[model samples]
Target: MVLLVPIIGGVVALGLLVWCCVCRRKRSSDDEPTRPPDTSSLDTAAKSLGFLETLLTDDRVLIRRRFDIRDIQFERPLSKGAFGEVWLCTDRQNTMLAVKKLLQHKNDAYKEIKDFIAEIQLTASLDHPHIIRFLGVAWTSMDNLCMALEYLPTGDLLAFLRQNADMLTWVKDKLPMALGVAHALEYLHNRPTPIIHRDVKAKNVLLTEQLQTKLIDFGISRDRTQETMTAGVGTPYWSAPEVLEGNRYTEKSDIYSFGVLLSEIDSAATPYKDVRSPETGEPLRVWQIVSMIVGGSLRPTFSDACPQRIARVAKACLDGDPNVRPSANEVIEMLLGRAVSDQNW
Candidate 1:
């Protein structure tokens, strides 16, 4: 009776184990059909880089400009931004260049790749002295996707203006800088298919060793025909009222930014920096300033030191009516006339 009882217990234990194993197998089989496929092999860095290379090859304009990653020699980082960094690099020929490299982990990899390609396409198609020169693009992996450009040691226009405020004469320095920017805008606006530089601020204007201005950063600039009625682009202080209101972007919007830039040049300060609230006597907040600007109740203030002719042109640019704002060519003419008169004086 004792041996029989032990045998019965062992048989029950084996039966329970078998049942559990069968249930587990059934559950696993049911889940297997719903499980995501293994995409790890397909989504690798090599595949992404390969895809980018294929896209670039398809672009006739870009195919000729592709630089092998081995040819570029990294020197040091010049600047860092949200999604990428600019490095001061050199080519095989020892020619110095600025290379903007994409940081893939910061954003959706596909979107970043597409935007980088778009920038490359637009920059390579452009040929102008007042615009930043696109040297070429290079990449070994997705993380190393890079755009090479001509290096400007003098830094951006805003920093240059502030640094040389005491030494820079209006005719020799400020006027020429403004004119160069105006010329760049004129070139962009008059393109066979016009381009609206949605973001035009002092920081985007880079200075050469000779302090000549070159318009840089076309990531936001769009062909006017392709532009929708999108708003909320550009630096607030430099943006036009129409742009703030989500109205269609036009060349006049750039003129408004140029007007704000004039204020910047004159005071060597950001637009509306001196503005204070009538009630609190404190500097107005960005929202308040934006509201006032959109309402056409506020325009950027000029310094007392600002020349009257420049102020006049800036005021015309900042006019509440978009129709009333001067075209880029008209602005150029007005400035040129003033420049000639100053030279005569």
Candidate 2:
């Protein structure tokens, strides 16, 4: 009986220590301090590296618009962000495309511009049904970056949920959608030089009319062969624990972010709710997500319209441990909403 009291005290002490560490991490943005991390040197250290071939393939791979881009007009603005806008464009070839027009940064260095070009090149190199296809790219004047891609008319998953879908339809919809997304992510993650879609969230995942999920927006994606990101490189919501902790890059981290994304999908909303966070008394950094779920601070209960089985999968995906979080392939199988062949992931 006396030994129990000391053990209880030790547990309380451990909890306090954890609180202090979390508080310290929040109070000081110390984690983001590393910068200008000699990417050249870092690249040398990578266990495996993606061929810069996509970027190096040169001017021949780039197809300049034959018809005046002005002549082949876009039907509507598909989306807008800090980097210019996206439009639904139709070429004289009658190919429907989603064009991303990037705003030129006058002060941007040559290397920075090349990096953006690299992203476009990477997209163009892949031709997968689950991946958003890169049709072509053009530098309209040096400053602006533009990419022509296969147009997806059905929009993203969040938009579908907002339409007031019923439970049965929601399950039917999410499962296949998740499977497609899993295929895309697994293909990226399993490469010799694995590509971490550093940003994996509802919005970046696009759905086609056929319901196949296509991964878009690799602006912040990283080659996992490298040790770590150069500090400030990910969208806050789907950022992983190690990313927040400023640890080295690992494929497991993407799995962590995927968990958040999966949870958000079931909840029918973006992962981070912009509400005041109880932990730091400020907006939550991404890793606070684990605490939020464990502490019951954030609830991802699916809407009444969502299926019960789908909701369970969402919760499982959000499991705090990245090791336990299922792979994108596993996610695909689950989305089929069939019996999981093995409970051990």
Candidate 3:
């Protein structure tokens, strides 16, 4: 009856082996936070899976495989969004680059690593003084897709506006931001191949040490030259009439967006306000904002300090007819106090 000792011993040994493997896996997961194995990086894993190659054919892999992400010094996360989390990162050369870590889930077969890689590529190609410089990229076998970008420590325009709302102080901060951002838009719009920053919100505009405004977060941005579209999207409040009609977009679309951004920056008011239902408190999306602007329901809500000239500048940008909108250069001239009014003629 008690002769089953050998069988029981084998079962116990098998259980111990399973337990050891589980413990080893747990240890491996923990080790990655400190010094992850090279093979576990998204770059390596993507190569191994071949999913990145297949999926990145569109725009995600346009400029990948350029710069190397040899080493990284991870810092606290600066912001989080639907696309990913942006972290302050220092590259191998000790250059500070903002790293965007995608939360696209582990084992996602879509191969967005190329897009992750492409962001750096697209960024590096632009050399405008007003735009944020594209530094480099970090690709490995890790679950993360780290994009190393020039770090702008002064934070975004939204923060700048929130902290300096009073008119006495607003003028000091507002003028530079408006002028700088106008220059950025002018640069993007005037490019041989134009680009539309589809998500042109206050949060996306970062300020530098010199107080110059730099555009950031092009996740939803469409390089108008690269990807021409009859219909696409952008933030609601800033969306123009042509965009709302689902018509083709061009540099003028960006102008329309700038108009809304100008309104938001000058007035310091949230987009699509006073329209939320009291029951749910949920707000509308970009499409809804576009609808409102299209229906003539949206207005700039100009402040007392917002000069009529600025009003006209904003209106020119927000004009329902994209054909009638002013160029970024024109906006810049107006903002810089060099605008020649039509009345002068």
Candidate 4:
């Protein structure tokens, strides 16, 4: 037994010596200047350990840009609205853009300023063919927020309708424009959290060189899921009766406004512009027309040129009962069905 112990100890020590020599030789081989470490194997091990994902999981691709005010040069003021003034601006790259600048200086301008910023942010996230595209936002040295939006060379729908009244003859121009606006509304209302465009008027609809209609001006828009219904937030002329009455308005209010816009497009004039006052027998003032709308008596008069089907769709939209009013998607179906029926005949 004692002799076997000595032999076993000698074998164990010899095995230890061989292992140490092998490890030393491996270290010396690793230190060779000409031999590069197996980085491909190391990368495979790293991926197996999720090291790459751990480093890149937090590295997100930024989709929005922050522009410096100095990069933009204002050319001229295009138009002024309740929220801000839009200008024709030129960027550092000599790119022409339309910039909306909020000029609220009053003490009570916080909400208005917030809405302006919100519109910029909201518009930035939307990407639809019929919805206006947002470029980026600029913070002026004077601490004012401005939005750079896509420039529509053909002006707004109101101006286009007035200047080109001959184009609204039939299915070629006017119906397509109406359908485009309807599709934009559908896009907004069909979002997971529906967006109600508080202001939907001809003046807020821009036209491109190809006469493509695009919806714009989301200063007073509300998300159905997140926002509380507020009344009296839209333009009085194009606003729905319920909105004028300071009632809790819904997406149906936009349909009512779109009805008015249809009338504007058909007549090539502003709503109530030609309507005579019942009592005075003269052209009614804007306030008087608003009163009539709230009274549920006066509505936009359809011109003789307006097709009966289009008029019917508009009438349905202008229904006093919001519950009976058709949704934007329904409006498109009505218009398209009418078009198909007419063609079939």
Candidate 5:
């Protein structure tokens, strides 16, 4: 009976061991499908540099679609900035587009990532003819973030002015181009949430093959409903006096830049090109120009070549006081009201 009890206890022990093994196997099997994603292949540098997760804003949430990296064929690099590289790319249908690949930095990737996302969000929300179109953004498995944008073949207005000086010298052509820019600003300023284009300059204005003008580069643009912006963050030569004084930027600041663009179109001369430093007779540096502007000493000299009416409008736009500067709509009205025959000096 003692030997029988011992054998029976051994059998029960073996059975319990078998049952525990079976239960463990079943549990593991169930968990196999629900296991966390395997990111084992990504090394430390690649995990930090390449990994990106998309977070859409309320504006882009419903409209913008995420694209796959496999669909983009990056052909050539068009431009490069501190945060990313803008490449000329083609899609599946062979359509040309500009794609910006945003890279992560070791120390400041978080804010850059946020800004890049914000740029895509704001750009995607806009659907105006004169505003550059935002196609889509992509987050690849390898952690690269890309934003596809509309390609303007003719390049920016700065280059266009350089190439087509003859076309711009005439008020007939110049007025229309100026009007197009005004209309674009009017659309932006009148939106439900007004967008202040903090960095408005000739380089930010792009021309289409059809000679259509479109405003691009909303990287520094801000919606007015947010906190007030008080940074000096624009092309120094095109900055308003108030901006140079470190005052908060308003829509009037854009008008100040437009005034410089007006002089650019009229004489094909860059703003403050003739302003020489008293100490060295060399052209004034950007800082000096800003000092002169803020000190209420320097103003863009409208060449005798510029018509009186156009010069008058430019002068109005360059008013030192922000309150005195004409709204974009008012500037458009004044330009449209003037006839080509009325462009007399």
Candidate 6:
């Protein structure tokens, strides 16, 4: 009887231990984050070699710029957007490159393909120190239609500023970055066709190891010659009032965005982040802020530490009337402490 009791107790304890382990595993499984669906096969199907060949053959410039994928090796991903992703890659000579790939599983539509081709062409044609350099385009199949560009090791301006907030200063860090972007904007605005960078925020600006700025991401840029330029298609915080109101996007709109960027440099935060309701003391909702901006009653705030000269330029850029905004050249001259001649707008 004594031996039987010990054996029975051991069995009951074993059962309890099993139940506890099973319960723990259940809890763990519930707590685990849900993994994104694996779309590798879909990505492969989208990069069909036949489709890539067809698209390349249609464009003469693309035909000449065809890159042999065999010479390139894939590295880790750097960033991602709605339609595609940018990857860090290396060439046969071990040169580092940023490769932007357009990955869509659906059948190739004419408009989408044309826009992508135009973006590649525009990027390749640009030649400026402040602009991101284009290397070439490559593809194994349609899913991998990729553009190779110069890789800046220091990353985008927004992240760099946030990460190095404590160490950065106005003259040494901020001024140069602002100047580089201004130069880039001036170049774009003075182009033969006068390009309008639809999006001109800090995230679109990249930095070098030396902290020099390089303006990038021309996915939505358009020549001033294009008809119907009223699409409200940029980030909300950096967008000009006219752009937010679905009015025509002019070079002046870019100037307004530049002004917002100046404030970003001063605060190291998103535009209008400090704005709050007087009654509730809570941050204003996005829609409320947008309404106030379009109504001309609100503008991005500058920190007290911001230099008076820079603050003045920022205010001029954020003027309610687009006609009152300073030109990119004027902004540059202002920053340089040179006299800016009055322009009859």
Identify the candidate with maximal TM-score.
1
Please write out the lDDT profile of model 1 over residues 278-310, one tens digit for every residue. Answer: 666687566666666766667876766667778
CA lDDT, candidate 3, residue 9: 23
Can you list the residue pairs that collide in candidate 5?
50-143
Give the per-residue lDDT digits (tens) of candidate 3, residues 280-323: 65654444434455655455556667767676777778777777
lDDT-better candidate, 1 vs 3: 1
lDDT of 2 by residue, 98-123 (tens): 98776554332333455566677677
Looking at model 6, report the run of 10 residues with the lowest lDDT sum. 1-10
**lDDT score of residue 244 within candidate 2:** 44
**Per-model TM values vs. the true structure:** 0.82, 0.69, 0.72, 0.76, 0.79, 0.81
Q: lDDT winner among the candidates?
A: 6
Misplaced by over 4 Å in model 1 are 1-52, 227-229, 338-345
Question: In what order do the candidates fall by lDDT, top score first?
Answer: 6, 1, 4, 5, 3, 2
- Per-residue lDDT tens digits for candidate 6, residues 1-345, read 000111222232332233344435533442133322335565653554445356577777766877898788989999998777899999989999999887674643323454576688889889999999988888765546789999999999888889988898898889989999999999999999998997898889999999999999988788898763554466776778767665668999999999989877777777876677656778766766666666666788676777887888888888878899988888899777684553432
- Positional deviation of 44 in candidate 6, in angstroms? 22
lDDT of each: 0.75, 0.60, 0.63, 0.72, 0.70, 0.76
RMSD of each: 20.8, 8.5, 18.3, 28.7, 24.3, 17.5
Candidate 5 global lDDT: 0.70
**Model 5: per-residue lDDT, tens digit, 1-345?**
000111222332332233344435533442244233445444743543333342453344523477877898999998887777889999999999999877656544545665676787788788888889888877644237678999988998878888888656546666677777888888888888888887777778888887778888887788876553554456666878777665667888988888878877776667776766455667655554555566556677666766777778888888888888888777787677643332211
Q: What is the C-alpha lDDT profile of model 4 across 1-345, one tens digit per residue?
A: 000011222222332233344435533442244333345575654443343223222322212465778898999999986557999999988898999887766532434454555566678768899999888766633236677889998999999998989756757899989999999999999988788998899988999899889999987787776434556456776777666655566889999989988888888887766666445667655655555566566688787777888988888888888888888988898888743332211
- The collision pairs in model 4 are none
Q: Lowest summed lDDT over 10 consecutive residues: which window, candidate 5?
A: 1-10
* lDDT score, candidate 4, position 128: 95
> What is the number of backbone collisions in each predicted candidate, taken in the order shown?
0, 1, 12, 0, 1, 5
Off by over 4 Å in 4: 1-63, 140-142, 338-345
- Tell me how far the alpha carbon of residue 123 in candidate 5 is from the true structure, in angstroms, after superposition: 0.4
